[model samples]
Target: MKRLKIKSFLGTAVLAFLIASCTDILNEEPRSVYEPGFFETEEGVRGGLTSMYAHLRYIYGNAYFYNTTQTGTDEATYAQSADQNFLVMDISGRGDITPETSRADVLWGNSFNNINTANGIIENGETVGISDALIAEARFFRAFDYFMLVQTFGGVPLDLGAGELAFNDNPVRVSSRNTVPEVYTQAIFPDLLQAVNDLPDNPRITGGVTKTVARLYLAKAYLTFGWWLQNPNNIPTYPETSRSDPDGNDAQWYFQQAYDVATTAIDNPGPFALQDTYYDVNWAPNDRNSEILLYADHTETSEYYNDSSLTYANGGGADNFAVWMMTWNYTVLRSSSSNTEWLGDIESVRREAVQPLGRPWIRMSPTIGAITNTFDDKTNDSRYDGTFTTVYRSNIDVEPAISGPVYNANGMEVAGGDPILTFLDEEPATPIDYSLPPEQGANVGAGVLPGRPDFVIGPNDISRRVYPGLWKLGVYRTDSGNGLGQPNAASTRPFNIAKFSELYFIAAEAAVKGATGSRSARELINVIRARAGMWRWDNSENEERIEDNSAEMVAATPSIIDIDYILEERSREYFGEGYRWYDLIRTQKWEEVAGSYEIAGDNYGDHTPQTVTRSIQPYHYLRPIPQGQLDALDMSAAEKDTYQNPGY
Candidate 1:
């Protein structure tokens, strides 16, 4: 594959803005500096492909849809910053949301932009007699884009082939609102099948799409479709709703299709396998591990592509948005000259003031009966470690409180020396300067308590709150590290993920559902449990180590697994990854999980609580198609209803 320098596209919003002086100074005539004919050469193709890849970066890059939506929802990553406050509101059922707020818009736009670029390459390439492999690559990319679109918004406006100037001026938008099966039949399945047939087994060297990547995408599509088709949870229209469709066969058929594709992909393992070590699997720079069948290649040089920056404090004032909000109360502290402590001492003190370093916003609420009941046995499982970070209190030796106070129920300043917890052991015994000159003895700040003695500190400590006096540990560094560089700074916190563990659970589910040919359901589940470093069901030799095998031996094991173990395992595995909210909805246990609270917290009194009640109406399952989109479409009532997902 040929590498090219990253260049801004002429028509892109960023580029256009950069070039434009002002709206009043806009030129009427089009600039013809370069022709499409010039872009037909090998270098041109390489540059075009590079541009295409850059667009893909926008989909997966920082502030992109993948980070915003996937991380925002219950797929991966937790929102740690206040900017991601929307996630808490959504998960906790405390706020109203419109489609406009969703990353769906950016995802839809970017995916289609990629598709259009791919289409341009495919269409124009034939005239120049470009390689069949390149054409196949384009087709593969187009198919992948369509797959993403279909999954998010069912039956999107399918734009196939090309268009003329007249047609482009007034594009006749197709209104089939194709069934889930139809989309698979027409767009995804066929395109992938064709691409797999034509594309090379390995195209990494060729700078193009590969059969292996195609297979992974196809398998993932099938798996997602199968779950959607077979599992009633995928259907937007529930039986309790008026918009229920009695199409039962569609679900089963999709599931079967999914199984077939996934099985094929699994059986024909190319370069994909699970990594042995967790750190090597996830944290490594090159995600080009044997396991990553499909992934966007990232490089340090690539603009906005670095993942390492996400974990550390950037010198810039901008906070590490994700880690700051999600990791509970974490902060940074600077040592003053008066307190000439080591770096270790500074970090130690900072660590103490914070409660749990990680946030519990995306946690599986104990209210979810299935999750709560199963994970109740937290001692034996290694999953619990991933779910919760144990907070250890520091052994900071301070003298016991000396106090004198008395107060009535009514507000009154009673006689008292509110217990003073002395931070320092004693004052310097042999003071060098018992009475220092006025010029040398400057007041820096008070001690750890109020009305305490001030000491001489450096100029840096004077401006910034370095001394113990102004230290509000909880409030301090609540934001990610701002532009200013400081020690023990707060940026993004690396939190727990349920990636590999969940895969094991998925494999178990597939086995239990009779999808795995060789392994029995119990055996598959046992393998998963063992992989997670948990106790095996069959290790009955010792009472201290063995798990009760009675549950594993049942005929209704899969159902029981779904009802009890699986949910709990999910909770334990994916506590802060944001899966809890959706899992509750899928299991039809939202009420049990979040019924006690009101929909909105009352702000009537002085101290207004932010607590809100959970409400899962039928319409809540699928968000309404944006009101703007609905208003724009000049459609008949019947057509509108047909196009909209059942609830919306």
Candidate 2:
């Protein structure tokens, strides 16, 4: 593929922003682009390094990229307000995931651009008196981007218009692809190994790379590469080569290496450990806690530092709008101002920039399997409550113009801070009245529970238009005074990329793949499960709920742990964080696990589910080389066709 103006923009324009605007870096007049000589200076090396960290914002927080990682997976599907971007990803015959349509392009362009910058820094950092530790940061990120790329697109070019892993000054019109093994063994493994040895234990900045994270990625890469070598399901890899490793290691050797590295990281955690409870890991107030290893950060204080408008966000690149996808229109549920009857219809749940409420796009919703199968034990497990906004409380008090107690579900009086709508954990003994009209206090087709003052929907009744919202990633702001605070603005919270809790899961998964460990797969998995059972604060009830069901959770695990069980635990632990597609792909279980899923229709209150089948063929495993790349390549049509993946 050809390096075009887009790559030039990444190298030049983005560097200027990193130098002048990034709070951690020096302040200078912003230049439109940088020259080849820039990196020769110490300032340029430092500035390019900062740009590597900033580049994450262009990928992780972009909602379209988030959809590509999820929507078609078993965790989620397209919702009512979904456009073509969300629909095509569903793979349910809405539209084909063409080269033009695939959102994986976000990963493609941004990662390559960052890789080129990394190449620039690595080449000149030592000559300019930059520290080895600082230079290793660039190495870590280079490997990081390559790891993501190899997994997503099978094989990618190591040379971006230059020699292999060399800095390219001039844009080129021709490119060649590397083999999968070559990309992993040459590009990813070497850098990660060097980064682990050269990096510091603690981060230099608030959210910088460390040896532990390096080890984590190294172990993860080894694990994923081992799976590719095993080829249990006979999945085809592009730029195809033998499944053999270049280093003469078999799949078992790599799996054991993965287990060893992961366990080593676990034993030697410098500044990282799991949070006390599962809720503490994801709760908005507890962000940047010890559990989070790395994140793409944004500040609520400064518009410049936040990288977008603090008061209003257009929801483009650098905007954390992924949480908006699964959120339904909770603002539509109404309450009565008169206690006697349902006359004054007031919107009880106003949109607020809080953990439970944010701007709802309603573009994606969870599958029934995610709710009913993966998170089956809602009573004992705290993850279900922590992951979703099950109970939406009244926020009328924030709107000072409004007054008086409002009547709800049973014509019962309620004020602010009371539950207006509750997605019930279990079906109540009394049948829910799904046919009740809006005038009779039923709204959004949600059924009414007898004598309850909150509109109720059981887990089975969750539909495309109205369902639980993703609470873990919901908006949080300290500036919302007495009114809804910047609900329309993209979230300023840092989007977490890696967590400390994943070490255990990685080790356990490696063990399941036939590597013996000091702790068995069951032992490692139970550690996460036991933590999930402990709850210090209940999000839905809006109160402190001290409960410890660790033993119960431990007892619930099957005697023999398998890959499927590990995937289930992963979904429970890291739901809605864009990890599903990779996990399913790694195990080669995408078709078996997510081939067909059940969800309700788009209309509100329509709880009847229809099974939707996806066309997840073997060739679909590797996303198509983006059409933009094909258009830029200086080659014939046949060469371009040969360059693309088999199916698309």
How does model 2 score by TM-score?
0.96
Per-residue lDDT over 1-648 for candidate 1, one digit per residue giving the tens place of the 0 to 100 score: 223443333321111111111010111222222123434554444444444544543443223242333232222222222233244334444344455554445455455445554555665666666777766777777778777666556555444223310001122323334454555556677778777777776544422456656765665565555555444444453222222123444434443444455445555555455554322333223244554444333332322322224334332212222222233222221222222222211111123212223221221111222122433444344343323322221112211211222211111111211111111212333322223222222211212222322222211111111111211001122222322122234222222211323434444444434454554445545544444443332111112343432333343234435433555555555443334544544444444544443111111111111233444454554444544444445678776666666544
List candidate 2 segments past 4 Å from native.
Answer: 1-32
Residue 331, candidate 1: C-alpha displacement in angstroms: 1.0
Number of the top candidate by TM-score?
A: 2
lDDT of 2 by residue, 1-648 (tens): 211111133341111112222322223334345567788888777767777777787788789999999989999999999999999999999999999999998888778777888898899999999999989999999999999998999988887776899887777666788999999999899999999999999998788899999999999999999999999999999987899999999999999999999999999998999999999998888899998988887778877656678887877767778899999988888888887777747888888899899998999999988888888999899999989999989988885546876888888888889998888888788988888887777778878877888889888888889888999999999998878889989998889999988999999999999999789999999999999999999888889999999999999999999999999999999999999999999999999999999889998778898899998999888898998888878888998888888889
In candidate 2, clashing pairs total: 0
Question: lDDT value for candidate 1?
Answer: 0.38
Q: Could you tell me which residue pairs clash in candidate 2?
A: none
